[model samples]
Target: MKDDDKAVYLGTDCGATTSKVGAVWGDGTVVSTKLLQRVTRSQDGPAAVVASWVDAASDFLSQHDLTWDQVHGAGLAIPGPYQRYGVLDKSPNLPDTFTGFDVHNAYAGALADRAGRPIPLVVGNDGNLGGVGEAQHVRGRGHGTVLLLAPGSGLGCAFVDERGLPLDGDTLAGMEGGHVPIPLHLLGAKPYPCGCGRTWGCVEVYTTLSGLPYLLEERLEKYPDHELAKSGKPMKERAFALRTLAQNGDPLALEIFDFQAKALGIHVAVMAMAVDPRYVVIGGGLMDPEATSDAFRERYLGVVRDTALPLLWPAQRTTLTIVPASLGDLSQSIGAALVALYRSRS
Candidate 1:
């Protein structure tokens, strides 16, 4: 690829609550990362959100003392289920109006208005891009396969092939991982409510921001008269207290977190068996070191090891290596920038 054809490698990651941008150099190094507050989806529709993205892009370029003329192409990492190809069906944290918006056309239009020149733009699902970034630059580079889990507002998954390419064309790999059914019987509990409006158990219904509230509320009911649950404090505030208590080594807090961790392990182990990935990189907003501590990781692994299910563990040394993503919070942007850099070459 000619240097001129390489473009600026402008990339954008429009997430549930944050939007980020970054630039990838010709040598595959990601530099000049920036993140702005998420657009207000409640008050703004898809058009307004894209407009905000344009504004953010302009600011990013100005901050770096760069010009639109230097940009060769742009790439976007958006949330999953791009309606029917390069479009969004629905984003829980984004405006509902974006359900059918054409991503390629929208971005091309936005950049043209801002730069006064047309540039090729491509879009991808954030989960798949996260997997790509981690596979190529973080944990699984040169490995056979990798599984990426974004465990925050929801549990997102992406399977990357040996070439560090996402398995699905673009959007199919990451949107439905959270919807995998869970066996309430194995959990030894009542069927939990899922965010998908079902009473059956699913990963996201208990693992996401929405699910955290439900988990906390159930615990609150169990200890209604406890100090943390007293007075008119919000349920979420009390939940934070539970987190604090867990950090401080409270038994009750440990129990609650353990239950959740075990549930997560079940999901991870299933994916591991299905793909036998070389590495599993975990990310997401709530994947803070605080929420998922070493003890939690150990417990999660214990559950995976103790499963009686077939092929849960093999005699051979398993090649799968689980690790936390090293990209910090700017991974989406870096992934997006890489997408732009590569697609422009193609």
Candidate 2:
């Protein structure tokens, strides 16, 4: 292939437990992809983790019968509280070793050294990139502004404008939607401690899997005959088991999902009021069909539509469309690649 036609970009999506690496063409077609588990061990330190990322990227190119010279640039999507420069201020899910680590420079330096040339790179929050990916998917389909919610080890949020570009600008400023506080009255009597070390309730604590244990305990107390409670499994195991039961039509499991859906709906409503987005895309394993079933999507959207309608007040609730992510779990990786393609061309 000619150099111009063969040109590709590298992208990485770094999560709490795993990292996804991929290479893609400028047209959004993925050339290669891989998942690296436990890539961010605290003992390994930030530099080591960053090295692993570079290794992954190089491996991806080799697997595709390409060379670093064909790579135009690289982009990264990471769980954050990070600056635009890719310096992690602090990550609740990441090891303490990553605090204040300049991940961008580390990856850029390592990759550049391997390629024997300078490489341009960009970094963004994983959730924000997911939003960008989804927004790009539906850009011309009548969706202008897009809001994305990622419920997983923690809750994540991001916004995109009419052109499917992130609204946070080059610095990625003001995109920390997960840390948005939830009213105490909205939460149950017990405190919902966030993974961010905050004792107070936040949207993440009540909407994601990590927070489901608290709600499960509340439900078990109310329904002593619940199958999950009878199993006596640990909190994490019980959470997964409950998802299975819910998919099987267990009443208690369904009830727990309803409670979670309500909380998520309320939060979405608040965000919609603020951003007035045309579409709200919910992503993450929690929303996948295998975890809870399509019914979870229906229930969650129903609550969002119903709750947000009155708040919108004469703006016509139909203006908003709440839906699941179109790109599914691959959104972040694709988005990171999109960022690289855009930045490299600029």
Candidate 3:
């Protein structure tokens, strides 16, 4: 453990199911991260959410025999749009109680109350933090630009620069890469309605877990021999079964992910054209750094690499590296800590 007298900061990721708190040092080192189940969830409201982080940080400090005086700053990460730094605009994952909430106003006072002096704070989107966390995982420096694409409930995107700081546009953090217009569709496929109410042309329509069944429907109808062709299972159940079959190497299932990888690759290529990132890290529920175990995901990511790489210029192709995020779920919390450390220095 680091010296107790040294300055420490709390970096937190307030995710949908759990809240993660990280103790961070000046040099972007995450000393420890504690995961706390957020009981009652969004119904608990923003004040309760802030209180939980304080209490969690307090518990950690007390347990380690550390003093609040060592806590110099804090950082928070969450999903959805923000009005500005420390002010949430709206988050579908969160309750309306946080709508238009001035987080900077509340969080500053909360941290100050515990530290017995003013403590600085920074707020950011989780996806942006993922990029920050991923960049730190890379060894050494000169990582000019790092881009992270997370395909989970939806397609989550994060962008970080050579300095290991998120280049979040307007500090909203969540770049909403999912809603970017669809650049390509394959295998005679048509637009399969998106959650954003777009009937056509949204990358999310292909990348999201929730929308998978619909995406599979059009393809499955043509292949009557596919086991899932006439399945009566619910959407979630069908999606799971389809993935299971894909893992087992079913032809139709394998074909589905091939199509998905292409669409995902196209989306990433579109982003690359806008912001040329040297590193592309893909990790989430779908992919990871080492993927020998999950054959389906491994193959899918292979196609992603094959598709996105050739789209770049021959010189750019050799420079661009596509890999998976090493830190997994904790990346966001580590990122939040890094953001706090950076801001405190400034």
Candidate 4:
């Protein structure tokens, strides 16, 4: 699709941190240059989140002198795990009212009010949409299994089949990759307790922003004389300082950061081995280049390169490339737009 010839669809990625919007045309031209900080899922209700989206859309259209009718369709991507037909099953990061909420109907109502008719609305999991966008846009029409990992409040994984089709449709078995058990035996460390209330250990329990503090605090005995505890500050600030120190090659800080990197790398390696993806696209809060350094990046990639399986296990040989998400945080919006475009065609 060419930029001018493509359908003009609107997409909103309603993230816990921010909402990103974009316009995709039929001619393959994408103009994604706007963002709104999240105001939903606070002490307020889930309806507040839907209302905020409408308000943001109105503001965006007003600024550009674009009418609601100009939008061919609208897509909204929310964090998962989604229930049957685009309902949120349980979004731990959001308000409790959002659990099992009818996201599609909520969005349709909002758009109908603004446009005088319900603009076609499609909803999807943010990670799923992001992977779809990356595979379609950035990867340029290749055919192979691919994995998209977004390490934010929790670690999320989205896998696309070799045919370039995502596996969320009815009748397909669910793919909750993050909830899969982590092999702590490989790391020689005590298994970290998971929020899932399972002591068996899941990958997200140790790899996410929520998990970072616990990992660092557990290792605090090694750095009691370090600045974080000594200053009576919070763990996150200390983690940042430790990250800086690691960047500067301080021994203790380097050790802690390496543990995190290694843990993440191990999960990636396991995912790659399981899916045999040709490429792995990484995004989310932790993927911010500011939070990690090139050396740390290499440490994460190294685990994939050095990973080995048991002799009896069929060792899969495949070339896997690791790269940053092309859209960064904007992926969900772009993906949502893509989904709307797909639905409109159907």
Candidate 5:
């Protein structure tokens, strides 16, 4: 390959509370990576968040002693409900300022100003990008669809076909599986309001970190003697503490984990029935084996399999496998880089 053909690509993953910036060669070797917290805050406003992304990307290039001329293109992944052209329609986890923001143009313009020339940039849904990363991770495992499920501050879902490409079409809409409704009868407790401002329950309300408190509240009266009920810590802290207890074999904590796993399984089963993905790759803070416990991860997977298998059509039961994400938190950024490389090559 010529020097020009050895171009590097930039990728940015802007999540609700944090963002990641990195550069990678066309062959997928990571050049540099940085994890930034509070880089994009709805409260800080959309423009500020976009500026933060550009600053982070610039820093990544500088740290590596690289220049825009060496970068063939850039790709960004953001929390969505966005247009194919990169206009964010609305993001449930993001602030109202992002409702109609021209995210693609803003990032491209800012980076171009830094580069002193326009750079090709592409943007897509974060979860969809994650699917691309996970698909790449499991490329040789088999030839079938892969479902990427990210359960963190919120829940996200994406699909990748057998070719390891995101299954996006003309519209950037249907993949918002997080907002899929949860039948009232399936929800044992009062429906918790979603970040999207829906009063009725959605899969997100029971699967994300934000939903833990509501789940705990329902079980509080039942597990009055449990440590979670006696604690006065903040909801986030309490959620972690509960996970710790679950890891140590506490009955109440185990019950909570079981409930969450089952709820997640229902959503996964629905997706599997609809898409019939060969692998379901689970990612994000809530499901990380390192963040929680290996036992927790195992138990969660066991429950998911137990809940989903019987519900699956008899022949399809043996076709789907639920596993932890191979890329862990790096999925989105790597996927973004892959997108950039794909675009540049095309």
Candidate 6:
């Protein structure tokens, strides 16, 4: 493992349905043009899923004429919380088999076995990794604390502290901000069930990709003759298209996003009041240029700012910068890789 030898490490972002394998330099340069992807096969069980990802990563490296031993370090970004580095604590989104599945040493040992030697490969929750990746990305480095709001399948909130490390440590290990409670009235939302089994008040219930479906049902009840209800489209599909429809001036879509953005903005305010991070990074499919139109992005962000600004302290209200996430979908993957590299050096 020469720091100057230009070794390529691997980073894997494991999602519920798929896993992406990427090649990266220790300096954080992604070597693979297209990320190598594979179905997660979570239904096969945790052990099988873990081994498959490792094998897939191994093969991805081989395509670059590299092997595990030639790698500097590797990192895995898992979707759920865990402790002792790799053991899974809970996984509501994954199959029931994943609960309490101890990954403590088996995962690291398996990597060592594959490389035929001890190399630095680590695993961490995806939320924490997203903050880490942005902290190390060229555009985001040296920016002091970063508060990241990731609003995709679920709402993910993470922090990279002023020290250029994830905010997680022993006392706050496995912290997940998505489940933090927010006022439901922010969206005129009722106590809808969250994926975490909470009946109400979770920030995720109103501000994520999954949350839209619930919002749709509630919103449509009042507008029974609304175009969305009459279209006969699947709830999920309709919810996903909310941004597009809003951009095209669909009144119902605009109203729903207005509520969603306002709720999300309030969530951000509450978190910012606690962390006081210098940068607030908002990202995910809802606002990605590739996923939604700029018209929609502007409207959503404007609503967020309007809803949040007055809630902040006067000083932070002026100094805090809110910007879109720079790394987009690649944040967690690259962050995991950075985690490996940073931990190895530390």
TM-score on alpha carbons, each prediction:
0.84, 0.88, 0.83, 0.85, 0.90, 0.89
The lDDT for every candidate, in the order shown, is 0.67, 0.75, 0.74, 0.68, 0.79, 0.76
Q: Name the lDDT value of residue 114 in candidate 2.
A: 91
> Which one wins on lDDT?
5
What is candidate 2's lDDT per residue for 213-265, written digit by digit as tens? 88888778887876677876787678877677777778887787677666777
TM-score of 2: 0.88
Least lDDT summed over 10 consecutive residues: which range in candidate 3? 33-42
Model 6: lDDT of residue 73:
80
Q: Count clashing pairs, candidate 4.
A: 8
Ranking by lDDT: 5, 6, 2, 3, 4, 1
Please identify which of the two predictions, 2 or 5, would achieve the higher TM-score against the true structure. Answer: 5
Task: Sort by TM-score, best first.
Answer: 5, 6, 2, 4, 1, 3
Q: Candidate 6's residue-wise lDDT over 1-346, tens digit each?
A: 5554677667788877778777568676767646577888989998888798778888887788876666888888886666455777666578878877765366677778888887677777777887776666534446578888888778767888765567766733544788888877656668767787877578887887777888887789877887788878889887877777777888888888888889888988899878887887887767567777878888888988888889889998888878777677777777788778778778
* Model 5 pairs whose backbones collide: none
- Model 6 spans with C-alpha error above 4 angstroms: 62-65, 138-143, 169-174, 231-238, 241-244
lDDT of 5 by residue, 40-128 (tens): 66588977887888788777777778777787888898887775569997677787778888989999999899888888898988888
lDDT winner between 3 and 6, please give it: 6
CA lDDT, candidate 1, residue 274: 73
Q: lDDT winner between 2 and 4, please give it.
A: 2
Q: What TM value does model 5 have?
A: 0.90
Q: Which stretches of candidate 3 lie over 4 Å from their true place?
A: 1-5, 33-40, 58-67, 113-117, 171-174, 186-188, 197-200, 219-233, 240-253, 288-294
